[model samples]
Target: MEQLKLAARNARKKTIVPVKQVRIGEGFVVIAGPCSVESEEQMLITARMVKEAGADMLRGGAFKPRTSPYAFQGLGLEGLKILEKAGRETGLPVVTEVVDPRDVTWVCEFADVLQIGTRNMQNFALLKEVGKANKPVLLKRGMYSSLKEWLYSIEYILNAGNPHVILCERGIRTFETYTRNTLDISAVPAMKELTHLPIIVDPSHATGRVSMIESMSLAAVSAGADGLLVEVHFKPEIALSDKDQQLNPRQFKQMMWKLRKLVQFHQQLAKQKSPRGET
Candidate 1:
């Protein structure tokens, strides 16, 4: 845990990770986009939609890691190019997952924030590669990983000299089969107490149902999450991946409206709290 000294929370301050021009810990950021970049039009359309709905950043997978080999494995470098174009056209910083260590530099060239997916959460080589790069990293918690293990993984990045790291609690595997993964809403405040890194929640992957995302997202904010990573698609019915959990444009906007209020309330509550971790 000592290795994570820079990321650990203290009585004085919280770590603020900056990506592009957006200050993550300073405000409640909403990062929304499709699960995968299916086409140039898909990327641009969703990017515009999310941005119009007040999303702070755009998220799309260029190199998707799937359970089945026959599934849509993303559009690779072409997808990255389209994501970059969409970000430029919309003026939103883009975030994409980088699974392999070899693609770090290429992904960094286009992505404002490099994401380490759940499957690659403990990929030490990939973590080290991204840690060495000069970009913010969004490290998601592995489905099977414990909270302590998650902190140690962050240590790997902070120890490697990159201070810009964001902790994303995307849910963990539990006995429940009703959702893709159990939404660990408690992890939000727990992590806040354990580490200074800004923490965000991924309700899209947590519940794996459109109807549950809104509730879980609100719960996350109430639990002290710094932001959210949501999946939004123009037409989720025909999405390439994670269609069931991806919120359509309308749903996303509605959720954003609700989230804005929740964020304000959270900030107000924070202002009333004492500096010594007291309310």
Candidate 2:
């Protein structure tokens, strides 16, 4: 808790990282795209699909950090170029993961928001590296780290110079193997009490199943998540990475429809409860 000087919970919320016009901490934001940038056509198609469905921003991993060394290690610079192109074409800001400290400076040229994946959540070197960057950051919770640990890691970025830091709860490692990882829904509200930073959820990574993403996403919203980090692909079956969990275009569109209604309801409810929202 002592390590969380800047990121610690306070009476006043700290900051909302701006990704173009999209505000990360102020209201609900949806960031959707393929887990890995597969190709120009794939990224473009998926980007337009999500944009038409009303996503706030786009996410496509340029440098993926996989558990297996033999797996597809992402397209690197090529993927980043494609991601940036899609973002430009669709008028949506881009967010991508940067694994190596050496790549941070150059990667910022392409990405609007820098992402710290679950594995690198506590990599102090990487944390400090991104912290030095001028861009906003999306820091996912470590697979096995506690809330305190996650906040502590975020402090690295803020302490280094960047104040626009967002928290993403992609789930946690637990004994049960039914899901890819256990989605901690409570963390959504807990983070509200633990830090001034906004928290979003990654249902795609949490439950490595297409069947559960919509429900988990709605649950996250209900639990008070500021936004979502979803994996959407034009063709999930043929995706280069995380295919099983990535939402196909049809599913994503349908999910977006439901999410919009839910978001509207939440907004109305909050307005009614707030003194300033009094009619």
Candidate 3:
């Protein structure tokens, strides 16, 4: 818990991030969308599906950070406009990644939640920049980072002033090749004990297989995670980024059907524990 003044453990209280009508830590909030905003039509279709399926927020990458330099690096400002319009039409809050410290300010104009991807989890400058913004931030765990390191990075944001922060475990790098990365399910409950922040899992990135998403998502929810960050494209097969990991909107709708029931059960259970349950 080194230098964890803001993100440190606090069993008596928890942080609740508000995204419009949805309160993230207060309940099971699902944010689903394409990995990147490919086109206006693509975004509109995807956003509508997720919203109709009961997702609380719409997530799309406007500034994708790719491993290859020559890959489709995202449509930048154009992508943001598409995402913003889709979110507006659907009435779902928008969440998009902010890669550079310079983009934090302008990105906020379009994004309700500014996401710090796994690749930039330790980007201190970007963290601080978002911390100063008016919007909440979704910070992902680095592929090679430990839980302690992740918390410290959160401090950089919290220390900058914004308390509306959410944690996402997209899995960690491991020797396994079958999946994109090894999902650390334990991190869900582990975060509950170590910090007051709400944590969600990204099964799409963690397992990197369409077959594994539903199961891992169920496991994450059952493990006491606050919510999930899922990748849902209208047609993942035609996606410009993370094609293998993205699920189609129809698949996401089906998954949402199950998740809604499970989440409702969890809500009822929480209500039973406390009449004024806000956790």
What residue pairs clash in candidate 2, if any at all? none
lDDT of the candidates, in the order given: 0.92, 0.92, 0.91
- Let me know the TM-score candidate 3 reaches against the reference structure: 0.95
The per-prediction CA RMSD against the true structure, in angstroms, equals 2.4, 2.6, 3.4
lDDT tens readout by residue for model 3, 1-279: 656777888644888888898898876889999999999999999899888888899999989899999999999999999999998999999999999888988999998999999999998889889989999999999999999999998899999999889999999999999889999999999888998889999999999999999999988889999999999998888989889889887788889889888878877876685646554
lDDT of 1 by residue, 44-78 (tens): 99999999999999999999999999999999999
lDDT of 2 by residue, 1-279 (tens): 765788887665557778898888877899999999988999999999999988999999989899999999999999999998998999999999999999999889999999999999989999999999989999999999998888889888989999889999998999989999999999989988988888999999999999999999999889989999999999999998888999998999999999989989998997775667555
- Which candidate leads in lDDT? 1
Stretches of model 1 off by over 4 angstroms after superposition: 10-12, 271-279
Model with the higher lDDT, candidate 1 or 2: 1
TM-score: the better of candidates 2 and 3 = 2
Question: How many steric overlaps are in each model, in order?
Answer: 3, 0, 0
User: What's the distance in Å from true for residue 67, model 2?
Assistant: 1.0
Cα misplacement distance, residue 116 of candidate 1 (Å) = 0.3
Error of 1 at 234 (Å): 0.2
